[model samples]
Target: MRLTVNGSILLTELPLLERPAAVRAAGFDAIELWWPFASSTPDQADVDALVQALADAGVQLTGLNFNAGDMPGGDRGLVSWPERESDFLANLDVVTQIGERTGCRAFNALYGNRQPDADPVAQDSLGARNLAAAAAAVARIDGIVLVEPVSGMDAYPLKTAADTVAVIDRVASEHGATNLGLLLDVYHLAVNGDDVDAAIAAYRYRVAHVQIADAPGRDQPGTGDLPIERWLGDLASGGYAGWVGLEYKPAMPASQTDPFAWVPRERRTAH
Candidate 1:
């Protein structure tokens, strides 16, 4: 079980270009990132600079997200949003190109919040179509498309591991592409009252990526009541040998104290 820091979470206070080095300085060689630029389709210079940052820092980008609109402003994702479907499609090439450059094989695609005025059937159909398209696009690079069940957002349909897997299955079946997988986030599962053990037992084979954050306050591992180690151990025991992303909110600034106290320094590296 290798560990990878989620740059979006760990380096939230720094500029996008500065995050790769910060992650490396924190003793992690592999990191995951959300779409770093505000625009899904950013200029080539911005892309080159981000690639260069990771190269200069000696950190590998293990995973990346397709642009989920305004992460801090509560926009869950654009792929499934009817109004933003085109934007999501347009971003496929951009994200895939970045993935190719960064050696990121896993790409998370969030299901958008349900629209109140739109017909539910239409929304579901559109989401399926877009997800199928996404699956095909990333398959060109032998990348896996991840579908995650997010918690705390009432409007989002996927709130359980089962829900996420169902979508993964749908995309795989619809597109005949086996590159679709589930991104099991322990925080979201625990927060939504789902049985983490049962989820791993049922879906471990389909999991391509795993994210961790303690439940309740969504804080670092030891800061909350969840059995973070046991869960991680369970994931390993269940045959998940992939990178586990640290997607938690650090309790304090990194300069004051190490945010990864729960994980020993030596265990943090992918090597």
Candidate 2:
């Protein structure tokens, strides 16, 4: 299992650009992030700084999200939003440059929430088109675009493996997009009351990336009753030889908690 620390969620104590070195110090050679900039298309210098930070830390960027507008403010994503098509497209270009510089091939596209005024069908259709475009962009670098079933946001539409995979299939059929796939996030699936085992068994091959956090509280493995180790074992046995992102919050402050005590020291590094 190649474990990539999710710098965006994990090292909240440090500045965004400094988390990669913290991740490396925590024994991971790889890290992932949500869009780290405030704007969808940030200045070239800002992009260059992030790339340089990763290089200095000696951590490979495994995955990154396309600009998913205001995540802290409850905006889940823009791919499915009707009014944000231009933002999504511009973000795709930035993602391509970041991927090219860092070798981060997997990109997670958070399916936006259902707008009260917009028809669900229309939102989904728009999302499919945007995702198809993203798939094509990343495909140039032998990369994949990931769609995940997120939790907590009631309006966020993709709530299960089936829901997300349906969109992937539609993109493939409608736009002939072969590079789009699923990002099977275990915590989100469990929170949404989906059968995690069944999801893995049913769509293991479609899984392009994986993320894990315990249920009840989005913390490390033992902080809750989730069978995280068991599920990871199943994924590996099922032939998911890809990155497993540690996308969890620490139970205590960064200075006080051994956030990664749950994972063995030797297994923390990328394989």
Candidate 3:
């Protein structure tokens, strides 16, 4: 039942550079993030500053997203987009560097939305290629590549655990990629009408990382109708001994005190 704060989503009131320290101060020794840089290949100094910030905050970088490209603009990911294949490939170097520097092994590569103009079969083919490359790169550090079923965007194709697992299987079969795995995001799966219990039972061994938020609002645990604690217990029963990323919008804004009051303070840190 180890927990880690999602620095990218949790401490939105602080500047990006300052969120790591805030996560640490809030009592989490480990943090995960979206791609922290605006550019796929940011200046080397910016990369160093991020590494230094984590080191100074005494928070371990447990997970990170590869450049997903304009998340605010509705671009789910670059991996499945034919036009952005080069961008996705170029970003892998930076991902590998960050993994090497921070000892972060799990990397989530979002499967992009389906394109109206492109062939779905072709997009799937290209996604497998791109994912294979990412898998090979991260394997250098003994890391695994994560593909998640995302929700909230209709065009985003991967909306169920089955959808993501299909892609994972394709990448493994076609490319012999053993390092690719599933990122079980409970919020997305629940919101998309997938059976969470079935997914946990079926793909528990394939799960590389897990994230949680209450669905219907994507907010903190108690604010919505999800039995998050029970699901966590189920995951433990299913033999999942990995970091559970707290990735929801705080019901109370980060400007206020104690957004994490829902979690017992002693349970906030990884065991």
Candidate 4:
């Protein structure tokens, strides 16, 4: 399996435009991002700078997320939020254009937290409608839209591989878009007490991308109880030949100990 880094996680202290170069300097040729723009509709110059940054750094953008509202403030995503639907729609074209420029084929659309007044049925219906639109938008570029199950966020309905796959199926059936897939983040599954091995065995075919972070502390692999090597072996045996994204928090700053010690230097580059 090929290895890629998540710039949002790896280089947290750097400027948005400079993170790609830091990822490249760390020996990874492929990286992913979580809507680096401050506003959903950033100026063209910002977009040009981002595209140029990736090109100048010589890194491939493996995956990206459509704007999730205030990720640091605990918001999951805007697509499914009834109040922010316009914001999600506004950012759709920007995301696809970024994908077009960066060769990123996998896009993650997070399910927002449940609202107090909205019923479950209404939330799901709206989520389906928004996800269908996102699926169609990215399908024009041969991109696959990902629906992920996040852990620890109870208000977010999708918290298991099965839950995420059900949404994926719903969108595919309702919109006739087969390009939708699941983004299996091992950290979330492990935190939620799901069997990672079983998940890979059952959902390998539907998985478009895989992200990893050790549980308990959500830090690098060795800082927690997860058997990283064994899980990776299972994924390999299950025929998941896609990028394994390093989405862990560094124990220290990038200037300190190497955050990627678990991944060998030779395996850091995309094969």
Candidate 5:
């Protein structure tokens, strides 16, 4: 399959060592990783070992996820914290360098929005400014910047696809930038009350990458509410030639984690 599955095993109770075997055992061409560089500096050998893991496991590093600033002593989001905005900028530089080293082409900088107590307009201005800075920084690298949409009903506050699009546009317009883009998360968009086809149709040319988690439970392909194959066909048809990222958590053991087990053989293309 041309799709990429992330070792989001970090978020789960799974041991990090097992993530690679799980990804390989499931037959994915690439694996996604959260931004190890941005979270903190790591030893070069440790970073090298990760690169080697991808090689030994035979999976490419497809994307790195990097979230922006959140407030200390509070739930303040990207738009609120001006104090540690340095961390956000520093993270971008780190991600760009990592992309150069590891061949990851895109990174997700999707930060949350606003403290419940903050004023809305002020938050927008803060987010837009930070995004503008982020756009300028990422444009210096070969890799692209990806912002995700979150759903308010879900748990995180900034879940709307429309909100993310607006933020990217505002940043790009403000900075006269070209590299800012979107990580279209199909499952989250659905959860936030968006139609996949409509969002895909609107943002086809603007998409830097796409990640797919089946809806309802965010599990393997056959168990969700999404019309997985047909929409994937539509994505390929719409000129989104990038890999379809499998970002779901498997409900079963890694042995049972063939994500495409439900995919009909005829529909799955040989990579």
Candidate 6:
């Protein structure tokens, strides 16, 4: 399994370049970077430079994460609130460009807020409309546009595997795009009450990328009450082949612990 350090959730102290450097130093071959790309340095040149840094470090670009509109880390997706559609598209373009430049073929479009009073049918329609529009745009490019089932946010409060699959199917059908895929986040799955086994079996094909962190607190893998090894083995058995993103919070300092020791070091990909 390839592990992405989840540059934001784990490596907050380093620049985007150094995050991958740390990953390489820790013996990982591929790494994940987050949005707020400007945060690394408010210069596009710097973003490109970070791409080079990853290359120099021998760390492969696994994926690029887009920050949906929200209060820092809120679940405000593009489709639910039509007003921010412009901002949503704008951000997508920025990240899409970053992906192209950095050799990234996978991108995550997290599900956003759902209007409390909006009829379920109408909400689905609106979200589908927005996602299809965005997916079409992404399909024109070489990258894959993936949707994450987000919880605790108004937009994508999918607590069940069925609900999550419905969103994925609707987005794909509505967009008429086959590039749409799923980001199976184990943390969200546990909190949303999804059956890990069933979810693995059902979404094994569509699950383009996977992230693992403990639920309840979104901490490291062993820190939570999940059967991590079992589920991971099951997914692998289901013929799933993709990067296994290590998107968890570090219980200690980043310098202190090798967050990915749980991952077999020899199997880690180098590019």
| Candidate 5 wrongly placed segments (more than 4 Å) | 9-14, 36-38, 43-45, 67-80, 152-157, 255-260, 263-270
Q: Pick the candidate with the highest lDDT.
A: 2
lDDT (CA) per prediction: 0.87, 0.92, 0.91, 0.87, 0.66, 0.71
Question: If scored against the real structure, what TM-score would every candidate get?
Answer: 0.97, 0.98, 0.98, 0.96, 0.82, 0.86
lDDT digits (tens) for residues 15-77 of candidate 4 = 888988988888899999887877778898999999999999999999999999988888899
- Considering summed lDDT, which 10 consecutive residues are worst modelled in model 5? 70-79
Tens-digit lDDT string for candidate 2 (106-212): 99999898888999989988998999999999988988999999999999989999999999999999999989889999999999999999999999889899999
* Model 4 segments more than 4 A misplaced: none
Candidate 4, residue 75: lDDT = 88
Q: Report the Cα lDDT for candidate 2.
A: 0.92
Q: Give candidate 4's error at residue 77 in angstroms.
A: 0.5
Worst 10 residues of 2 by lDDT: 254-263
Which 10 consecutive positions of candidate 1 have the poorest summed lDDT? 168-177
Alpha carbon lDDT of residue 157, candidate 5? 52
Ranked by lDDT, the better of candidates 5 and 6 is: 6
Off by over 4 Å in 6: 38-43, 71-73, 115-123
TM-score head-to-head 4 vs 6, winner? 4
lDDT of 3: 0.91
Tens digits of per-residue lDDT for model 6 on 1-271?
Answer: 5566677676776766677787777777777855655331237776678777888888777777665654466644555655655666666666767776667888776656766666667766766776666666555567787777765554566666667668878776666656777888888888777787788887787788888888767877778799887888888888876788888877788679766777677766544
Model 2, residue 160: distance off in Å is 0.4
Residue-by-residue lDDT tens digits, candidate 5, 1-271: 2667677632244555456655666555567876543244556676677777777776677887664432232332343355556666656666666677767777777555555576667766776776666666656666677778865333345576666787788877776656778878888888888877888888877777887777788887677779877877777887878867777867786455555576454433336
Q: What does the lDDT come to for candidate 1? A: 0.87
Compared with the true structure, model 2 gives a TM-score of: 0.98
